[model samples]
Target: MANIMAASMYMKIALVCMLVGTLLFVIGFSTVSWMVSSAYNRWEARGVWKVYSCGTSFCTYLSYGAWTYFGRNDYEHVRATQALECIGLIFALVSLLVLLLYLLVDSCRRRNSLIAFVVCVFAAVFFIVVGIAVFAIKLGYSYHVGWSMGFAIVGAIFMFVGGIMGILQLTCR
Candidate 1:
């Protein structure tokens, strides 16, 4: 009974952590500030999908001129980073389905469900970590790394901890 209680606690923790991680990752993944730089009194920002200017209080994604000075010309690994992070985001979102299944289906409440969810969480962390690492490495030192990168890293850490909690939940059974 004690072990079952402990496992239940772990499961809740894992679920909360994974949810937070997924939210953070999604925010960072969408925002246009993963990389930022200022030149000629103009601020430019880059995210997974768009490169825009944050020179004014409100950013303008339509500013093609903004990227001419940075981004693609300067970074070789941008596309790879996008691919890895996208894959990670997809895995994280898909893992939530396992939780839904466990809640809705009697058979999915078994240990295998926990294992599958944990594996998906871990896979998400793996791809996110690699993507962040690649971006951090390939991005020029002259530029200022933005909050989006930090968010992505923190998100990956949360997912990783969640995965550990999930493993503990499995052991209790």
Candidate 2:
């Protein structure tokens, strides 16, 4: 039974990692694409592009919020804190998914699209590390060795790469 439980825990950890990793990857792609699309639209049209640009900004900020919230420890109101964090995560994930569909269908030929794809893969890897950290936390593992700043740094690197891609799109494409 102990062995079975350990296996189950491992499986659970893997599933969480996969889901979260994929979601983060999607979010990274959406954010960079949103920036590129909004920039292009802003110059092409009148101020009408504000709507789309603002929406993109909102999504980017929310993605950051989701990551920060989930990455924190608010133990006073555990359920409420976690619920809010989950909501943020869900919103970020959904926005990314929508943005991905748009890119795949309407903008695959763009340079930013390829950059987005690469960032997504990187984000996925970081999320897997985060998942492992979460598993360690649950199993009463050491914080320093388990869920440490390493995962956070990895996540930051993904966003940084996405930002660089966004910047490059302005001049290169």
Candidate 3:
């Protein structure tokens, strides 16, 4: 009984953080407010998958495979950012699922499984930071950063903290 109680504390903490990270990743990935442009710029808001035009009220969805651009460069950087974000989201989701399994299924609470979960969490954070870096590099501080980027950054920080707690659990064991 004591063992189960002790394990649950750390596992629950990790699960909650992973969940927040995954949710933030989704919100940031889909929202059209990653970079809000100034009055001088042509676009009003920009996301990984969509762009809102300052001139027009409508927003344009960026098709992944189409490789289209809106009166600008080829948007090669956008495509790369999209791919990296997708990969990071996948990793985050999978790691969260594994953590859930650890919480619900007794057999999955082994040390090896915990190690794998931590590895995936680290990978998710790495890919997400890389994607953000790639996106930021494209504009080079010309546009103002928006809430979407902030969400992603905070999400990564939460996940990292949770992973550290998981490590503490391991060390304590």
Candidate 4:
């Protein structure tokens, strides 16, 4: 009974971390500040095109000037990065579902939950890492990195920590 309780506690903590990470990832992925540059006036500027934006923000997923800068290549790269971020978000959602099952399903197999959680965590990390790599390769040299990148990195770290906690819970049981 104590073992079960301990595992439950760890799983709960892991779930919290994963959820926080997912939220951070979403914010980071959508923001246009992933890459920043400074003006002569010392003002920081972000890329004009981003994965998500509104008219109020004066940014879009693709802008007319993007084609002027790199033609179709920039557009394609941004689209691909957006797809990878979406995949990471999907993996996070799946992990949340598995965690919910782990908490609620008394009769569910423990091994299945362990496997599912681990796979989801790793998959999320993989997608996030790839997306960040692409962004870095495509834009890092041209512009300064910004808070969005930091947020994504921190989010990935949180997911990694949650994965480790999940593993510890399984082993302790």
CA shift of 111, model 2, Å = 13
Task: Note the Cα lDDT for every prediction shown.
Answer: 0.78, 0.35, 0.77, 0.71
Ten residues in a row with the worst lDDT in model 1? 1-10
Give stretches of model 1 more than 4 Å off.
1-7, 54-59, 62-66, 69-76
For candidate 4, the per-residue lDDT at 154 reads 84
What TM-score do all the candidates reach, one by one?
0.82, 0.29, 0.85, 0.78
Name the best candidate (by lDDT): 1
Off by over 4 Å in 2: 1-74, 77-84, 107-145, 148-153, 170-173
User: Which residue pairs clash in candidate 4?
Assistant: none
lDDT of 2 by residue, 1-173 (tens): 12313322322332244345444533432332211222422311111011112332343223322332236743323233234334434443542453344234444435554455435434434443444334334423212231122333344344444434433433444
- In candidate 3, clashing pairs total 0
Give lDDT: candidate 2, residue 81: 27
**C-alpha RMSD by candidate, in order:** 4.1, 21.1, 3.0, 4.6
State which candidate, 2 or 4, has the greater TM-score.
Answer: 4
Q: Tens-digit lDDT track for model 3 on 1-173?
A: 12434565777788788888788778877787788875653566777877665555544545434433455457778889888988888888878887777766777877887888888888888998999999988865668788998888888887887787678777876
Number of clashes recorded per candidate: 0, 0, 0, 0
Weakest lDDT window of 10 consecutive positions for candidate 2: 43-52
**lDDT tens digits, residues 35-91, model 1?**
888865777777777777766566678533345553555545777888999999998
